[model samples]
Target: MIVPPPLRFGVLGLGRAGVSMLPALRTHPHAVVAAAADLNPTARAQFTRDFEVPAYDSAEALCASPEVGVVYIATPHQFHAEHCLLAAANGKHIVVEKPLALTLADCDTIIDAVERAGVTLIVGHTASYNPTVGAARAIIRTGELGRLRLINFAAYTPFLYRPRRPEELDSASGGGILFNQTPHQVDASRLLGGGMLKSVRATAGVWDPGRRTEGACAALLQFDDGAAASLVYSGYDHFDSLEFRVSTEDERSLSLTSHGATRRALNEGARSPDEETAMLSAMGYGGPAMRSVGPGGMGMFQVELGLAIVSCERGDLRLVADGLIIYDDEGRRSLPLRYDRGVPGRGNVFDELRSAVVDGIRPIHDARWGKATLEACLAIQQSSKEDREVYLSHQVTVGD
Candidate 1:
């Protein structure tokens, strides 16, 4: 019997997103990091020391490694296309972090290259992998949500400062909250709405002088089903927020909030018994007890890698649900009434990536989905600049 080659991986770009994969990769049974590539000497050293994997000076070297069967790209917003193209050319299955590329053109370029290469190309859209998102998808898939009419998706990042450094702050580098932050919500909206975006009308503004990009953006999206989503994204506020409320024509609603305070009380040191009770009361009882639902057990990214490994091994897309099963806590799994069963306010982009990998499917936030999100973001910027309601072209493809 010919044994299949072990799916060795090389991770390119060791920033926040890149580093998060270390724990997940270490735990995966079918895949291991053969090498890692990053430009920063300190980061490279730390990654090598942490993972005991060879460290290369550049992504090109890592992709070229004979042992590497796959490449995970976690570089800054602007470098996704080049890295994926290089890795795909080198015959490596590519896993790119979300927003596929900075622009629709870049997304198309990367997609074309990956298609030509005939290798698995998956974007790291972490939101879809979220257990709550999974449960939500399952619920929606079952038509329990019943002809969704309105989706109010909001993500607020307080202390959301755009980088002051030249390399990190440029719009070309994916600096804006609308562009960088809203893709997750966009994907979620698509998931719950069950339709393509027909058009987008947006308004945005930059409240902070230091940040050239909009600190707040609101978009009104009309879907093919006549359902509409009101998306409010704020990068600067007194509070950090992540929430999605899906309401259907059947008079039922589901709200998913992945944020900070809720996770801390649930995952970290225990609070006073009274405090715990209060937390439960505030979160609303999903059932007997308040289960913490925050992002834990595996961060969003690690979950993504794990999902990919499992899916590749399984040889089918059904693993998407499998990974979700692994992550689901009662809070995450419970229906509308059980919202408080899991910890609130925690999810990582990695979760969606791994789920897609396991299921042998790409998410709505695939290259096309990313493009639509970017289009909406760009429209917001355009509208903000022109002080007019920017209307998205109907002919645009939201995602393929």
Candidate 2:
């Protein structure tokens, strides 16, 4: 009997995202969950028992396991840099959840380790793999929108009801809405921009001063091709206001937004029936406007995982090389654009993490691109804090 090689995976942090992704990882053709680690002993035990896999007390121990070929770092934003470095040092391919690292210096650390070890590192900005996002890219590529002029996107959340621990809310722990939630939008903007960032100008504020982290931020980005994007984000707002939108050179636009009773009432109260008066102020639409909206969490995960599996099997090299090309009639160049309806209650990221390992192809969330995104995040934070525009360097710096 011949024995098959298994791409054994070591998972660190069995949190919500990690737990959710386990199913997909297990389904992968060449991957198997061999070892796991988490700070939470109960979580570690539960995960290991559930999967019938070996469990380690720490990521270090899990990384040291010979059975593990890849390491999935699903820890909080603050720990991503350190986790990636440790995994790389152990010669394991890595898939880290987004934001890469909290700072440029941290990103440099992860980058250096990966390069020095010659290991693959992928950032888990799963939004980049969504089919709707893909569709948007495709549309832009077709020039149906007729030249990219301005892109406007927003992500809003009501943090009042979240279950995060006090430490998790610290800015240093990557607790801000910008650091914790902005990576998806950042990835979207970069994908749409299709070139390196030229400059970034941003203004953000923490509404409750007590929070000290950002409550709202609006950023302006200029890509090398003169394509511009205006990204707005808020963490202090109500849950009903989430939205994402894009506008084109031809005056057409696409929008997506969530709906709620308050939002609907606001819209209804905008006009006065008896006096034919504008009952609400233009700026008082409460916040940013959106076109389409619905529940979007779980569905996003499933799509993301599926793409990772596909990208891994086919090799991410081709996708990376061809990521930016979309042509139009008259032989003009254009970017890709896609629009998709949101789905609810689907399995996600963990699933893809598992499957990618099984396929023997490198995971979609590799180290190099992850390092780049982390570097971008760091640059954004620096620009925001220093009140000056920051530019992404052509050559990325990493730590070993």
Among these predicted structures, which one has the highest TM-score? 1
TM-score of model 2 (CA atoms): 0.67
- What TM-score does structure 1 among the candidates reach? 0.68
Give the TM-scores of the predictions, in the order they appear.
0.68, 0.67
Q: Lowest-lDDT window of 10 residues in candidate 1?
A: 308-317
C-alpha displacement of 171 in model 1, angstroms? 2.9
- Poorest stretch of ten by lDDT in candidate 2: 312-321
- 138, model 1: CA deviation in Å? 1.5
Local distance difference test, each candidate: 0.55, 0.56
lDDT per residue for candidate 1 within 1-400, as digits (tens), equals 6644446778887655554555455455445678888776766676677678887998889989997887888777778889989998998887777767777788778878877887677666445435555554564455533545665555565424412233343465776666566666665566556536766777776676645655677777777768776777766643443221212421242123323443344434334435443333332212223233232432222221112111111121112222332212222331321222122112233333344555565545455555565666666566666866665542233233
lDDT of 1 at 296: 41
Error of 2 at 192 (Å): 2.4
